[model samples]
Target chain A: MNETQAETQTEIALDVPWNVVVHNDPVNLMSYVTMVFRRVFGFSKEKAEQHMMEVHQKGRSVVWSGGRERAELYVQQLHGYLLLATMERAI
Target chain B: MNIERDAEGGFIFSDVEASLAAMFRAIPSAADPEGSKAALDRLFPDPAAGKEAGLSAEWADYVRPELREGFENASTTVEADLEPLNAGEDGWTIPRDHIDAWLNTLNQARLVLASRYEVDEADMNRTAPYPPESERTLAVSQIHVYGLLQECLLQNLE
Candidate 1:
């Protein structure tokens, strides 16, 4: 309502962490997903392969967790590689 | 068909038959998601996964176009590389730099075909060597071929 209250709400929203998750796709190759992870997030080969395996064995993997804006950017990069990725506000 | 690395670390596919050449030429069109909503949705997925309507709308207006442009550019690169094949050549060379574009374009085509045909892991494993009797079967074959191409690029990339 008031400027101070609005500013407080905005700050609260900004403070909340968000997660970038990549979901499993029947079409995307494991090696391809691993490569995308390496390129987009600069993940190491082992780290990227670990997450890729998680995504393959499980349904999804939380590849990154941080500020909402960064999470959104990561999701954008993942989507650019045609991976099934999303950003969600962390509880 | 056989694939080998060129002197500059690029990939050269030799002995590409007419059918394989045809498949290479089809990459650009197969990557086009205009006619299939499923393919389009898979390519430009909602980053928020439907949780935030505002974010979804913002993504559609601001981000989707950029993504589409990137896909088109990759497809263009692949199409340009296939010019020799289009001109009745037996094979084409993927310069080291163009590897990413080729991989991306091939992936796009595979995803589009998979989405359109509802292909799953089972479909991918179906390698009976039977002649494709239906459109769906042909699409499956195409997906496999495109996937093999992607794998070839990845192996060379590594």
Candidate 2:
């Protein structure tokens, strides 16, 4: 590939957003998951419950999306709450 | 067993019968996920979900230990809170300060029990009683009871 085209591709890869996803688990209480989302993300009650319900119904939900480092940090906090969470490239 | 709220917003589990007390006392042990690989995996899941091996390994090396330590600390707090029940008292009082620990430890125990038994969503949703015929059945009961306790704490905190 051309030099500029390669650089553009490299920049795209470097700038790719990461998503913090929470997967549903029967063992974890729905209320508890909502609480974690609220606490970790400072999400409002309505917003937190919305995402919690999404995870519960859909098996998983991207709870947060941002820089890879921040996504990793959010995943770490969700894990601290014992929720099944992971960070992945948005693409 | 009767659960009530104290003036300080803590839980007061009074008249806890022997059977329930035994269950409560077992919390610390049940919370330990060391023996079962599945339980350990549940407690310390990969942060990158296998997509990034290096990130997952770094998490295991550095972050997993912190998570384990946090779980252990929560269990310790719960164990200390159960002293009254441990000392032959009919009931136990969870001080307001230790509410979060109790919640965390109870959740940990439930997760461990569920993992050890290979419990799934259908099992959790089962309405009929598990025929108490094996250790696996007993683990199911433990998970339900611990789940109830966690629910109580969450409701009270609301």
The DockQ scores of all candidates, in the order shown, are: 0.84, 0.87
lDDT of 2 by residue, B23-78 (tens): 88999999998889999999999888788999998999999989889999999999
What does the i-RMS of model 1 come to?
0.8
**Which ranges in model 2 have alpha carbons more than 4 Å from their true place?**
A1-11
**lDDT, candidate 1, B3-117, per-residue tens:** 8899999998878988878888999999999989999999999888889999999999999999999999999999999999999888889999999888889889999999998
Evaluate model 2: give its TM-score. 0.94
Full-model lDDT, candidate 1: 0.90
Return the top candidate by DockQ: 2
TM-score of chain B of each: 0.94, 0.95
The regions of model 1 sitting more than 4 angstroms off are A1-3, B127-131
Q: Give Cα-based local distance difference scores for all models.
A: 0.90, 0.90
lDDT of 2 by residue, A1-91 (tens): 9999999999998799999999999999989998999999999999999999999999999988988878888888888889999989998
